[model samples]
Target: ARWSPSGDRIAFVSNSGEGSEIYVYWNTSNTTSKLTQLENGPSSISWSPDGKHIAFTMKVNAKAPVIASMPAKPKGAKWAKPPRITDRLKHEADGAGYLKPGFNHIFVISSEGGTPRQITTGNFNHGGNISWSSDSKNLVYSGNRNENWEYDFRNSELYSSNINTKEITALTDRNGPDYASKVSPDGKHIAYLGYEDKVQTYQLTQLQLMKSNGENKKVLSNKLDRSINTAIWASDSKGMYISFDDKGKTKIAFIDLAGNISDIVENVGGTTLGRPYASGSFSVSNSGKIAYTYSRPDRPADIAMVTKKNKKPIVITAVNDDLINYRTMGEMEEVWYKSSVDGRDIQGWIVYPPNYDSNKKYPLLVENHGGPILNYGNRFSTEIQLYAAAGYIVFYPNPRGSTSYGEEFGNLLYNNYPGEDYNDVMDGVDTLLKRGVTSEDKLYVTGGSAGGIMTAWIIGKNSRFEAAVVAKPVMNWISKTLVADNYYGYANSRYPGQPWENFENYWKFSPISLVGNVETPTMVMVGMNDLRTPPSEAKQLYHALKLRKIETVLVEIPEASHGIASRPSNLITKVAHTLAWFEKFK
Candidate 1:
């Protein structure tokens, strides 16, 4: 709770009934005054070098859901009034059933309470890492402003703008995404991560440096082909620190202006909870002191701080200390196996149930990750832990398209996903069975979104699983292409041609095509407002199962999105419902 610059006062966020407000606490006067009174929450407050104003992001009220015009009162003389037309979009939302109109944008306000001025405007959503230039006259951020913003997930470019006039200028124009840009301390250079674009997938993101005005761009880590997760400027601005994954381990490295790459630290833990994937985040102070979240196999993620002189790190957050007495947690162990389809080494993790006895057989739950492109690494995941706590052995693998394995390994399933990756998952399950960690009769499968599609596909191809829970799955490519959030991207990248041109390929990979072979009791769940992997996808699979008289049930989480378990209450319900479904089969 220390103030920056002169340190006369500490600036922090204060919560009230309406929302969170920024406040500055004067140490001498022992008084607090509000800096912002935004209706929505304010965060990432950065003080100006002159300490006159603070820059932060705030959510502004936007357009409300539109309601279709209702037919004039049915010419009925007895009707007192015509029924009001409620918004369909509101009714379709999860949890809240409808959304309160809001859009996130960057804003600046005085350190003392006053009217906050909006600095940027557009339909495109913008909020993530934000930083101020050395002169404190400009703001830098990353967001997508393409014409087709809804379907352009990979087109985010770094942008900078003058705070006074709000005149924006693009810093990088590339086919692939560029994000996490930070202006160097001296204000001459900026560092960020970028990669070449491939259809439907992303490559290993490398650290790049460019002048503040967007000239002389060059990749700093050309020799280090691994993806650079994040980059931060050093105190002197002569060099910058970066984090990347080597194999499955997270390493912190530094690169000087001359492009000399040196590993500053390695084995910095942070992937806790589920599998041991390379995941960690670090923030450096102006004094070169680094604070990071660190984790180990036996523990969850915790904050730690380190300095150059004192290489030894100190844990700041004690989340694990409170859970040490709990006996229901599982122990995650990294596992490696050769793919049956090919000799490629597949990496995954096995979570053994607490109080597990080798003599007794246990049920196994194969969980698929959402992003076929995103990796399921050794990061802390509450969803996986709850399953392990329920006496179920959980297996989460990176499959073929998962990141951190290199560009080639990640893009292996590019246009051919659910093909080789499917074999890789099944082979991993077989390997686990051979290890005697799971029984065939007690095996179950479940995943949401991309993983959901895989779960449905698995049951369609094989009846090995006793039961399956497919959450927010895609059943029809044609329908998905038309209705999904990123409809254009999803359809264009997965299929070589349009639906009419490549109907056979779409059907060949779709789970609905093989629904007739599904005999296992399946439970399908979807978020009512999920634009990505819309609920209609799950309904198709459920209706198909019902038509064939297969044991099936469809559960819709109202007011939720593809990320249905984002809320704590919803997470509990999701876990409870999934466990109940598996228990009924057991």
Candidate 2:
């Protein structure tokens, strides 16, 4: 989506027939016009400073496959399917299916309506975070045009291209991937985020500053150890505001000319629509007004506006007011306790069954989050709320390796993921058990992706839980490194070496290695089309349990990917299946 330079109008893409088309709407007049009819969807859209034209990124069609011969047949004779051949390492992606042969390129069209013209030409794909200079003469974007662009994925550089002359110039020359350049209001400096490619398991993305000519590059966030998720320059250019996570909570802060950091707001997220995960966005206007999505433990993101510093924000839109007013929600409570294995504090949230009795114990459901790099915070979660509504006490913990914590804590599982994280979560369960909030007989555990790995790990290590539902987990590292959507990072950065060099360590970390001890009635679930943690991974655990004469069932959500809850119906199905499994054991 592209907001006009004057902020008077907005242009966005929408689905049209078989593809997508661009449209512009006037905020004042409430008038809209169809702009372009393109074959493929436009990925990025940018409005020119004068609002006379729009620049966007669209995929260029890949060349047709080369076939040795074509067999002649009758009018409608059946032909054998062509085999896919590719020398590229990164080919297909989840949700996108087998990738089409194409690269993303930049294009521009007049706001008055005309044929769109292609700007940048290359075999390599151009990426988003496209920024236009104040004069509207040039466009800056990130891409890797090197010979081995695909293999050297972490070597993107910032480049500028003249809109008319088509002349290109390299702005920043760095080994690491550098993009997301936002030209300052004065157009003298550019603020972007990147880090040197040290090939480490975890590296913080530092906010950087450089001249318009790409000189005198400095890391503005050098002192900040936590990663910067988003950065926007203040209207004056003397400082910039950034949003980052700290210890499972997301906050927005401002960094001034003297390198002083002052928080503008805490708890800056509620963007995770389905669950309480760390996600949100903020934007600043030239008039110094800030607009963001406000969220809390009780509600999802609502439109909020703030003009003054350290002042309360006025929420403009209450998206969930009707639902919130009508439906009774579970009570959310924050819980903090030290890890039993290590003397470190762990954060989690517990949702109690509505109209609960403090004296009576309740069934416990431990939900693990994906992205050992992601976190669960004080945000409204539908999945958690649904479990609570089902008369279960739900606990979602941000264990070690969860982000929003500092770099050290996020990288704690660098070489030991699903290892000590188990202890951290089990300790959280123990905390509730000791308080008599949950009884051992009614314990249940479930998680997806990385959480799925932990769920499998939990049942294998301990049988305290009555039932388990492991969803979309990497049952074996060797297979995951080969088939997972992210084929490179799993071994290269997460571990020190390739599977061949570190076979012993890889085998040791795999959840399947300990499946022999499984005795719990486990339900292995996965998305039928999950590329991140393929169905094979779930099958491995199912087969392992069956071989041990253990009670187990495999559930595959049809037409779903890594994110099983991506669709509304799928989310309901996931929750239904989970509750059924847990209830059966109870």
Candidate 3:
């Protein structure tokens, strides 16, 4: 959905199916009209400031490449299908699978209704967010329009396209990515998020500003340590509203030209249901009002707003009230402990069971978070809460490589992942154990993706846990580095070079390398179609455990991608299977 410049109308596609029609709803008249009927639905919709035209990006399919073909069969006979051919570095994604042979091009349509006109051309994808200049004569967007765009996937530059002439102009020229361009209300400057390529595991995305024509680029968020996720210009063009994760919490703040940030609100997430990674979006209205998706530990997102008079936000909508009000949720608490490896203060969250008894001894579940770069904050997580409700004190920590902590902390895993980050997780566990939270025999560990890698590493490193559930993990880095859907994207940044060039470095960090030492009762799980960390990775662990004569089981979810929890029933299946497996050892 895209909001009109006057904020009086909202343009949205009519349906999710193909051939969806764009419809504009007028707030003043409470009327709606079909704006356009396109074959494929439009995305990245943006309205011109003058409220005259709407710009969106759409896929324009290209003819499939054909090699040698068999002779044309008779009309009645249906011969075998032709073999598909692909020579691209990234031909398929985890969820999207193989992509259509086409490029996404920008198209413009009248706000009223008209045939859309394509502006940008060529084989490059201009599908990123579209922002308009204040004058409404030009459109700004991000794309890798380079000749070597497919290979240099990490690099992107901002481009400005004249609506009438269809002339494209590059506005950024850095080795790293420079995208997410947001032109100020006054059209004096353009702000974006990017960083110089350091060829490292992680880099903080800084806020940068330049003149409308892309001159005099300067980093405005140099003083801010944490990466800024979203940036929106103030209505009056004084400062910008930015959302970022600080420590373990997500915050919405205002930053002036000098980079001084004053927080407007905290808990700016609830959209990511599977895990509590940083997520959410906010936008500023003309009269100094901010609307955002409100987040909390007890519930998912609800519509919220804050005004200049009331700096504190007001939750205006209760979308989850029916489900949340009736449920007795676990209590979540945050704690900070020093890392045994470096004496760094590591933060983690403890979710206590519902109606807890201080006298009772509850089993502890160490639920490691994915990303290895993403942090698990004190936000609502149905998965973690489910574990807590099942009578285990769920402890999720933001280890050394987790984000929101400065760039140094997040990039510590460069060429050393499953490295000290493993110690950071164990240190949190040891701290809780020393406080008599749970004994060694009652411990259970589980995590998916990167979290799964850490969980496998944990159980292999020690025999304290009663059982372990390693879901969709990279058991063998050498295999996974070349096998996953994002295989080409992890080479130099993750390690020093290609897997073959740095074979020892890759294998050294793999959990499969430590599989021989694992003694915990294990249940390895993965989505059957998980391309990110494919089902083969899970089977490697299962086969190894079987050969070792260890108590183990394999659970493969069918028709699921890397995001097994994307479907509600799939989420239930994952949690149910995890509980059933953990229940066995208990």
Candidate 4:
């Protein structure tokens, strides 16, 4: 709801079975009506100060997908004619291909109702969390429009355009990445996160501020030893609220124009999902009330509301209540251990089987996360829960390269991954065994993407695991670089030299090099159309296992991409097959 210039009608987007439409309920008229007839959908709606028009982001499906012709119709007496394929890359995409062709950008529609006008254009994709100027004369957005767009993943910049004139202007120019730009309520200053490129494993982003015209840029919380998650401009426009993590816990902080920082809430934001690694998001109302995503050890992330007057937060969304009533899922507990290689403390989480008992021993499934850079924080994850509910103890750890920790700790595996981090996982397993929570005899391991790569590496180096499943892994670095999407850029950044310059280095770190020593009964899974890891990587491992006459199976998820388990049905099947493979050995 938007406060009239004086403050009254709240305009909101509602789905009425047809599709998502915008509706403005007036305070005086006590009436409402549809403002748009968009075929796709619209979201991120904001009001103009004068209440004359509403600006929103619309997703339009511009073209129908193309399909490849299959074998001639099989001996059918009568059959419906086949449709022509219009999209070239339709079948190649898992779920994303089915989506309409379009990019998210600003669109202005009369608050009363009419046709909506698209404002921003180009091939560059716009970032979310958009905001409007106080006067509603302009709109601000974040996107990376570098010359090498596909390869430049960390070069997003802030931009602003006139509502009527459509004059676009670049806000900030930094060597590193910048994003999450928010305009102050007064429309005088902009707040965003920026970081310098250090060629390290992960970029350390700092809170930064500048004038609306992108002048006089300065860092606000440079002294703080944490990366800013997101920031919101205060109501008075004098300061802003920021979120960051320290010691594996998330905290909400307030920063003033003078660069002073104060912690408002500590250990507050964590959505109920996997092990808690610091995960949550907050949105502040004009009145200073903060609504955020909250989670606990046993639940997934839900909406929570917080105010300065009430020191405690109130739960706003209870999504897991019904699910929990029908079936009990395993609860997660945070576990920490010192790495055997460096003595550095490593953090991980353990999810025991549902209705767990200490007297009975259970099989352990060590799951690795993707990104190798992304943290497996406490967030709602269906795959992990499904494994736990299937009577397997799941273990997920934030090895040396995981985020939430400081830069020094995260960069430990920049160019050197699957190295000491391997020891980190082994040490975690030993710690659980020492605590009598897991047995070495009934151990299995699995992971996807980078985690999948590690799984292949683990089975090659050790015979401790009885069974293993590696999903969408990069078996050979030399072939992976040419096959994967954004191949040139990712390969250049992760490795010190090109494939020709340092052939031995790539072979030294690749898991496929050690496939000859693998003895564990392994199962390989991957999306048939995955561009990131590609199917050939999985094929290499499958062929090697078959050549050795070892017990192995290769399951290819059809019409899926790098993220094989994106769809609800695919996720269910992914978990079921993984559990079935492990159950065979058990």
Candidate 5:
């Protein structure tokens, strides 16, 4: 939902079985009105400063590719459905399967309600979060309009489009992503986030500022090491409110024009229920008031508000009170340790069993977070709580490759993943053991995706864990790099060149390469219809363990995607399965 410039009206979209449609509500009258009959809902809906119109991005479908086929069916005969054809490079996605031959374009409609007009024309997907000029006569957006956009997917340029003339002007021309434009209310400046393509495993996006006419570009947050995720201009345009990950927590702060950043609040995420991944959003009002998602370790998310007058945030919603408040929540503690590989500091979070006793011994469940670049912070997580409630101490570490530790640290896995990250995690585990939080005999491990890769690598490196569950892992990098949904995307960034070109290097980092020495009882699980890591990747581990006469179980969840915990049922299934598997060994 988005509030209009007038603050008296708000606009939002809703799905009514058919598709998403636009709706507007007037705060003064307490009345709502339907604005669109759209089958595919609009996104990035923004109201003009004058509140005379609203602009949004909507998808425009194109004709699918047609080819020569067999003869036509008989007059009244029923035949099979025609095969779907596609020639696009990145055709399918994880949750969203197959490609819809369409492009997102900007549209505008009057505030009183009327037909919407398309202002941009292209076969490219114009991103959302579009910014408009103070007069609302122009709009700035990001898109990969280059001819080779299919192959050069990483490169995107910010472009300004005139509402009346519909003239498009390119504002950025670098070989990296330049997106999320925010036109200052004064119409003098435009703030965006991007970074030049260094062609590495990970790169931090810097906050950039430029004139409205696209002149005098400069990096505003150069001195800051962490990647800024969101930015909003102050009412007076003196500075901007920005959000970034520091250590393992997401923080909201105000960054001035001179690059001085001051903290506003911490613990900015809890929207992701399945995992403790950093996720949340906030918006600033014209009066310098801010509204955002308030998060806690015991709750999912609640509506919170803050004003410049009062820096203290007032959480206005207790959406999970009925359920979360009634349940016993485990205690969460943040721990830091020195990586054994190097003396570099590493961060991790531990969830002790509910009503814990320091005198009692409990099994240790090492849950590795995915991304290898994404950090798991102290956020409310269903899976983490379940594991902790199941009577085990849970540890999820943000290793060397995790973000929020500067770009150098995140890119530490560049061409050398499963390298120092393995040691970083082990160091954390060993630290816990030394503190008497857990014992070696009751150690268990599990993770999905990159986390799964790490779990496999950890077990292969040492038989320390009594049981292991590896979910949706890329066992063989060579096979995974070529078969996964993002087949063409990971080549040069992950390792060097194509998988075949650097066969030995790819195989060296593959978890399957070390599976020969595995002795821990393992459970291999994956979504049957997963496209990211694919079920075959899990099958590789299951097959290898079987061939070696190792104890293993393959759990293929039907009709699920790479995100096995996307559905609430799936989330419960995953946690239950992991707990069940670990129980046997415990």
Candidate 6:
């Protein structure tokens, strides 16, 4: 959703009905109007400077119904289904399945309503970092136009298309991706984020500067060690402000044309509605006011704004207060301790049981986050709070390889994940025990995706935790790299070489390889329809543990994808089942 250039109207998309439609609301007239109807929703909406047209990316070449020859029966006829012919390497994706033979092309239509015009056409898809020139004559966006784009997911370049002539020109030529173009206020320069292609699992995205014509490119944030998210140019056009995660918190910073940097605000998060994971965004207006989703431990995201430094943000919305005010929430405290393995500082948070007493020891329930790249921060989390509410002390940590931290921390597990990271979690657990908060004999651990990988690895390494639940984990790295939807990119960037080239290394990292030492009663959970970390990974571990005489149970959520808690009912079920398993063991 975006406000028009003139600020007199707002343009947004709605998918409430059978199809997605674009609508515009007039502030003066106090009336709403539908601009256009689309077969599929478009993304990255860019309103022209003159407020005459809007540019967006939409999928082209809609597939026609597959026809089959069949003989009709008496009255009730049954026809054979048409066979699907697939020829793409990256054919299917989570949430969206079965990639059709089409491309995401840029299109433009009048603000009032008219026939949409196709601006760019090719085999490759174009989206993200879309912006219109101040003159409204051209629109710039980022896309991978290079050949073998599907194979090389990270090779994308910036391109600009003439609104009238429909001619497209490449703006940046580099091995790595350069995207998220934001035209400066004066329209003389473009600020975007990019990095050199080292083919490593992690790399810092440097904030770059280039002339309007895409010349004199220079990296304005070369000194910053963390990856820059996005930049919104200052009203003066002298420098730009960028948001990045450092350690366990998200901070907003400024980068000048001379490569100098400074911090603006800290604790800029709360966009992630589900878990207390790292996520947030901010937008700066031309008048120097900054609006962002503010995060806190007691509540979810609330709209807040700031106009000056060192001043408290004025929260303008109380969307969750109606329910939060009536609930008795648990207390969340920040924990900082050194990793037991290498003495690296690990940031974590512990939620005390509701109506807790310091003298009483509660059972510890350590929750591990997925991504292994994503980090948990000081935000409202339903799952963690629910655990604490059930008379259990919940612990979540941002170990090595967690983002919001600098590049060095995030790359700690580049090729050595589930290695020292296991030590980090154990150290966090030890810290809680030392603090006299949790009982040592009734420890429980659970995690999803990469977190699931760590949970399995932890149980294999040590039996301190009495019960374990690993959700959607990759028990065997060799099989995971071959069958996962993003095998090409994951296998190459995450590891040194192909599965056969680095067979020993792959085996060394697989949790199934160490299943012989398991003694803890473990439960394996996965979404039945998950493609990212397939259920087969869970079955392999379950079977391996069973063969070793280890008590194990497999819990598969039907009709669910990689995200098991995508629906409200599923979230309730996942929490209820996990808590039930822990109660049974207790």
Cα error, candidate 2, residue 534 (Å): 0.8
The segments of candidate 2 whose C-alpha lies over 4 angstroms from its true place after superposition are 74-76, 308-310
The candidate 2 region of ten consecutive residues with least summed lDDT is 303-312
Cα error of candidate 4 at position 529, Å:
3.7
Candidates in order have lDDT scores of: 0.79, 0.86, 0.89, 0.78, 0.91, 0.86
TM-score preference between candidates 1 and 4, better one: 1
Backbone collision tally, model 3: 0
TM per candidate: 0.84, 0.96, 0.97, 0.83, 0.97, 0.95
| Ranking of all predicted structures according to TM-score, beginning with the best and ending with the worst | 3, 5, 2, 6, 1, 4
Q: If both were scored by lDDT, which would come out higher, candidate 1 or candidate 6? A: 6
Model 4, residue 318: distance off in Å is 3.4
Question: Which tens-of-lDDT digit does each residue in 1-586 have in candidate 4?
Answer: 4444544676778897598888777778788777788876787777777677787777644555545656666785567776744432222333353344656677888877889888888766665556677788888877766766555666778888788987778887766777777888888998888787766667678988898888999998877767888888888998888888765567777788998887766545544233334677887888888887775656667777776556476887888788766878788788989998878989888888889998888889999877787777554566777888888888989888877787777778867867888888888888988888778898999999989988998998999998999999999988887656545555546778777787887888889999999999999999987888889999999999999998999999988888787676777778888889999998
Candidate 5 residues lying further than 4 Å off, grouped into runs, are: none
Cα deviation of 481, candidate 5, in Å = 1.3
Q: For residues 548-580, what per-residue lDDT tens digits would candidate 5 score against the true structure? A: 999999999989999999999999899999999
* Residue-level lDDT for 574 in candidate 2: 90
Model 6: per-residue Cα lDDT over 1-586, one tens digit each: 8899889999888877668878889999999888777767788888998999999889887554446654556687666676886666777776665667778999999999888898998788898868888798999899998877887788889999998999999999989999999988789999888898887667888899999999999988888888888799998999888888777677777778898888877767776666787678999898778888888877788888875464478888999899999998889999999987888889999988878999888999999989987888878888888999999999999888888777778887867867888889999999988888877897999998998999999998999987999989999889999888776677757778899999988899999988998899999999998888988999999999888888888899999888898887888888888898888899
lDDT for 543 in candidate 4 is 99
Q: Which digits, one per residue and each the tens of the lDDT, describe model 2 over residues 1-586?
A: 7788888889999885567888999899999888898878887788878888888899999775675666777797888897786656677888777787888888888987789988889798786688888888888888888888888887888888888988889888778989888888789988888989877656788898889888989999877888899988888888898998877677788897566787777667886767788888898888778888887777788978876474477889988898888888889999999998778999998999888889889999999998878888888788888999999999999998888767788888888877789999999999999999989899999999988999999998999999999999999998888888778656667887888889888888999999988889999999999988889999999998898889999999999988889899998999999999999999
Residue 196: error of model 1 in Å? 3.8
Among all windows of 10 consecutive residues in model 1, the one with the lowest summed lDDT is: 86-95
Comparing 3 with 4 on lDDT, the higher-scoring candidate is: 3
**For model 3, how does the per-residue alpha-carbon lDDT over 1-586 read when each residue is reduced to its tens digit?**
8888778999987674457778899999999898887867788888999999999988888877777778878999978777888776877889888876788899999998989999999989886778899999999999989999999899999999999999999999989988889999999999999999989998999999999999989999888999989998988888899999998788988899877878888878899887788888887888779999888988898879986457787999999899989999999989899998879999999999999887877899999999988998988898988988899999999999999989999999998988999999999989898888788778999999999999999988999999999999999988997888899988889889898999999989988889899999999999998999989999999999999999999988889999988999999999988888889998
Candidate 2 pairs with clashing backbones: 62-101, 247-404
- Where is the poorest 10-residue window by lDDT in model 5? 13-22
Q: Record all residue pairs in model 6 with backbone atoms less than 3 Å apart, i.e. clashing.
A: 245-404, 246-404, 247-405
